[model samples]
Target: MLVRLIVLALGIPAILALQDGSPWPVREFRGAWIATVANIDWPSSHSLTTDQQKHELTSMLDTLLDQNFNAVVLQVRTSGDALYNSSLEPWSYYLTGRQGQAPSPYYDPLEFAVQEAHKRNMEVHAWFNPYRARSGSSSKSGLAHNHMANRFPQYSYAYGNNLWMDPGAKVVQDFILSVFRDVVSRYDIDGVHMDDYFYPYPVSGVSFPDSHTYSAYVSSGGRLSLADWRRDSVNTLVHNIYTTVKSIKSHVKVGISPFGIWKPGHPHTIHGLSSYDSLYADSKKWLELGWVDYMTPQLYWKIDPPQQSYPVLLDWWLQQNKMNRHVYVGNYASAVVTKSWPVSELQRQVHLSRDRRDQLSLGNVFFSAKIFSHNDHRIGDLFKSAEYSAPALQPEMTWLTAPAPPVPQNIHASADYRIHWSGDSSGSVRSWAIYRLRADVWELTSVLNRDTLEFAAHPGYYAVRSVNRLGKESDAVTLHVGDITVGVVGKK
Candidate 1:
């Protein structure tokens, strides 16, 4: 039986009988955030041996791969530190027990993560907390001598037991840019991701002590309101970061996961912490100006809440996506923690994202990665049986351009029913997808990386499409085989 494809941005239609039973889209952003702060999702703890860290990360990637997740947003820079080698910042205490201490015998967690993730055909986006400096337990005396906050106290401030970089400081912006530049230049990361920690969530009476910077700005003839100035500072960094990443590698995406509520009264009766006023993120402006390649807002609420409805908030964010960039809805996995949330809510949220494909909100990314291994909540089983039974290609980013890869050159059946095809030499081809014609409809059977050039064929017409590093696909080349059929295949 033929099923409607869910991945197509085929546009809306007048009448439709399509149901959830339809074939899951071949392109979707099924991802999970692998948080490393405080060892919440990785390493198990900072004290583990280097071997243990590698084992833990490998296992996590393997599990997510089996579950059909295409991307992992790993916390490489948890709080003004590096999970990988860096001359600009000290090592993250989360990776080693002490900040500035490298892993025993030396190993780069970011490098390892990128390599392992690629092995599984999963894209890795280096997640960075741009403004956060120190966690609650960290103290200036205890921080590394070379730590940015310690080295340049003027650019940093302590608020409620944590250190934060003054967003308004030009030096802070330059330092952050250098740190990211080093990362993008040295690593093969798929994207650079930032979360919604701008200006820190408002404390009841505590204010972000940026008066000195604000004073300096006003003395230099700044007239914008403090809020607008703060927003502008963040906007500057966001836009510069996008341009910088593209300059280094035009295909690498830049994404931000801002707080769900953009601002109060933006859809009326939507009551929540205003990312605009409180956090000074002005994330809506980022979307409008086309600064980010994708926006994954943390929409953690249940589907129907009296104060902040999930769907309402989702639609609001979708409308604000004026630049047509990708928006992957971030969902909280109840399984991540033993919470009061119903297990079914995770599945429901996934369905919501898929059902509204035509309306924008292209895909979904779970808040965490570890919980799926628990199996206590049966979250893995639910996805395997429902949303993720089939494999998916990571969605394309039209903004980052790359020429379509050339089709496979030669194809023929070898011994033992195994099919062989020549690999393309075009630098753009990262992998190849094998599709078998079944019931006169093309069905994806497998996706092989550039390393593998053959697969065991199970009989039928076969076709291959080259996928580039940015996940863009080339035209297909097909070959029909029944009795030793051999020839250069053409597009179907």
Candidate 2:
């Protein structure tokens, strides 16, 4: 039953009220990675049909929506392949039973993902591992003969059980850029994301055989050392991708989640594999140079660990954020099931992030999304009940420009006390936020999707504002409530 209200002289708060001492910000990034490689997160298995795969994805998104998650980082290009249509690469073996084979009914997962995520008012970031040729086992022979790895053997190298595109080669960089540009130009994604697999995690007993490429660079009068040259190669790709994505769609974001520890002794006490030295990824320099829109270091450790303290590393990353880009902490939710980490471990991490509100440390992204559906250790419930109970707009990027939509019109009160307004058809408006006057202030009651044109009034002063795809809110239109007769309804 809707509660009756008389006009109050006091003003209500303009946002979703902080109900339970919540330290959450009005704008925060809450997302999860939906890994599709080797069926780590989606499809459960490669044997599922198209309808079944669709059902599993829908259910995952539904779970996130129910838990109030606002974004999804979906792995589309897992290992030098495409989950969507592509002329450059073959179909992902994890998506179908075999590589180079299309779904029986033929559907593009990236397109379907963007459409479904938008319907739920969730942003979908298309995640790709730019240089990985194959993971775990050699799929080189299985890959289509026309695949780049097959066509251009000189561009790739085999190390351990994996195949990788030599980062030192200019031709390889151009090929990778073209593949990603194809996706960015065709699909309507919110962001382009990549994981920490730069130069591939070091494999013992065998080194990445890039000597030929390095020798070529040296013969061409390159000045830098081998290590610096490798970092420069990745840095060039990072800068190129950032510029290319913005050139195509300025509002779309570019994010990278690199290895957590930058350098062991940089923090004095912390000791771990150096992302800078071993992986040749200069994540710190990237932030200092403003090459990325956001950075998520995989801070997959307990808060008070002796060496790899989560808080200590979090602060270190924050200080390195010279560009003031969004720095989301990469959390390991799958560890809860695999390592039996207490559910409270996740809660403490969330609290630590909120408590330390530095300029760069904004929000979090769970490792994989599947565990949420299982309710493993009640991790999902803890987040929903505590930190994420209130809704938040995706954190804004002031560097990108987007037109603020015009205020919605035709605000009127219906005879049944339901408020109605004219829907914006400009295709920019993503949803409408309904604000109600309470305690003399306006507070957000609901964020109605664009299709929802009317809202049942709660017998109070109301205002509606349009929110754009970039999470920018428009000025609101007001609708006043008056004396009306309405019947009471039973409680659920």
Once fitted onto the true fold, the runs of candidate 1 whose alpha carbons sit more than 4 angstroms away are 1-23, 335-338, 481-492
For model 1, residues 89-185, the per-residue Cα lDDT tens digits are: 9999988888999999789999999998887888999999988998784368668887889867987888877888899999889888998899999
Error of 2 at 320 (Å): 1.0
lDDT of 2 at 281: 95
Alpha-carbon lDDT of model 2: 0.83
Residue 90 CA error for candidate 1 (Å)? 0.5
Candidate 2 Cα outliers beyond 4 Å, as residue runs: 1-16, 21-23, 415-417, 437-443, 480-492
Cα lDDT tens digits, model 2, 171-202, are 88898899879999999999999989989788
| Consecutive 10-residue window with the lowest summed lDDT within model 1 | 1-10
lDDT of 1: 0.82
Error of 1 at 434 (Å): 1.6
